[model samples]
Target: MRATIKDIAKRVGVSSSLVSLYLNNRPLAARIAESTKRKIDAAVKELNYAPSATARALRKGKSKTLGLVVADLCSDYSSFFAQTLLDECSRYGYQLLIGITHYDPEEEKRVLANLIARQTDGIFYALRLFPADFLKSLNLQNYPILQLSSAAPEFQSMELAREEALKQCAGKLYEYGCRKVVVAHESWANILEKELEAYGIKIVGGRYATTSDDFPYLNDTPPDAVASDSSIYARLLRARCRELGIPMPYLCYSYSLPSDFIDDPRVIAVTVSDYKTRLSGIVSRMIRMLENPKEPVAHLKEPVRLMSLDELREYRCAQLKDPYYEPFRIRIKYEGN
Candidate 1:
């Protein structure tokens, strides 16, 4: 059985009230001699007692746990972000409890409510779609609520400048001499689409609403080169491209992508240093803000590029300049020795 103050008091022949006062560092009865304090300390050591977590929490309001919720756990990016956040929570002397909402409004509400009931000190929410009532229900007036990737207002956010991220991808794609570039994805913000179009790159992929037949961009057979929203889709596309005889295409990816995907002969991915070092830049900054709300915090944003098969062979060391866009290279690799 775990030792408690009562055990110590019983062994020392003193009231538990006196033991509590000494343990809490409260001023003892003025007449209580220092000898009494020494005796209590000796009894505590002999009893080998450790305070309960419930007792510690009752004393300090915080349980030293942070709750994190993500829209979906299936995405590669979400998995990467969760690991990063977990590591950051450990660094801050806090435990992390994660929940997946799968972008469901009802699920998010239920998960968050459970976390609150458990007294999580703070919350980190990463959702693709923000339900209308989510913010209304959250009593964040006193708590520090952080949005890891989204820019919702109810919570402070850690975001990469969306335009800048897209621009980096576009500029690099242009570098590899892609005469005919077809950019496709499930869906992206209208503002981002316009920016990609401005680069003279064709936005071939249909929007989330477009049916396969309407646009037929990439044609399910895959294009010469492709950049996807996630690495899983990228590899799926790569395999499909091989089956269709579409030459191994140069690809652009995010930091969330793994190295194994890039190492394939048919794929040469841009390696962003952020993936290896300080991958938790977002979570780390969020935790720092929680530690010091008034210290003038800033978002952590950096870029990393991956090169695919065609890029690796064509521009292994090729340096070129572009007048219209950033002087970048679409690094690539070759497939089928």
Candidate 2:
């Protein structure tokens, strides 16, 4: 059996109440001698006594645990986010419970419910296909729930404030003489189109492809460039171009590019935001909210920028030195040397 505070007191031959006061670092009465305190400390170590998190939480009315639920862990962004979040949680003396649901909405709901059932103090989510209306049905309106990437308006969010970045991206493309482009990920089509049009550029087409083979040869306007929200899709665009004997430069969001892509110049520009930094910012806010106990609020935005090919290399190269990059495959090569 695990040693309890009672065992420590018994071993020290002292009252449990006296031991409790010392263990909690509560002010002891003057009659409680310094020698008794030292004895209790030694006894605690000798008994291997550990505090009960459940009991402490019951007394404090909040668990020192947080939940992180993501759609997929295979991606670079997810791996980076999970590791950085765990590091942050450890610093705050909190435990983290992670759930990976592979973008399944039903599984997302189940994992979320389990987190709540387990009395997690707060939740950080990055669900691609989460149903906001169905979440409202859970009646978690006041809960400390924060979503990453996009603003749901229903949940307190740390969104990738995209307007500035998109503007810079469009300007960069315009500078490269790209007046027309096709954007992959149709959900972002209208937004990218609006931004590009601001720079007098036009969207020739849009495709939401999951596989390289899903890219179709577009006959409209013969785009000067192709932009994609996913690294995988951007790769497919490059493949399609090469297969057709056409040279093309593409743009991709920096969300999931493995750090190894720092050397690849085929990518023209990146809509860049530091996911680890944004996660840290929201986590600090969430910790404050949980400690103080308040109603959840509306959306919050985190600014992003556009990194040209040269700038992307410099930025990613700097990230290679950060501890967060240890999970990247590049780390294997880095450590091998």
Q: Best by lDDT, which number?
A: 2
- Cα lDDT tens digits for candidate 1, 1-337: 8999999889888899988888877766544678987898898788788878756874687788888887776654566567767776788788888888876778988888787777887778666425646655766545666765565554566654445555666666566654344444443334345665666665544433222223244456444445554555555656665666766667654433332244455443443334423446655665666677665434444553444445543333332232211112222223322
TM-score for each of the candidates: 0.68, 0.77
- What is the C-alpha lDDT profile of model 2 across 163-249, one tens digit per residue? 777767777778888876777665456577778777887776544444445655443335777777666666656666678777655
Clashes of 2: 0
Off by over 4 Å in 2: 1-49, 128-133, 198-200, 205-213, 218-222, 243-245, 255-266, 323-337
Native-vs-model 2 lDDT?
A: 0.72
What is each predicted model's overall lDDT from 0 to 1? 0.58, 0.72
Error (Å) of candidate 2 at residue 151 is: 2.3
RMSD of each: 8.1, 4.5
Q: What is the clash count for each candidate, in the order shown?
A: 23, 0
Model 2 pairs in collision: none
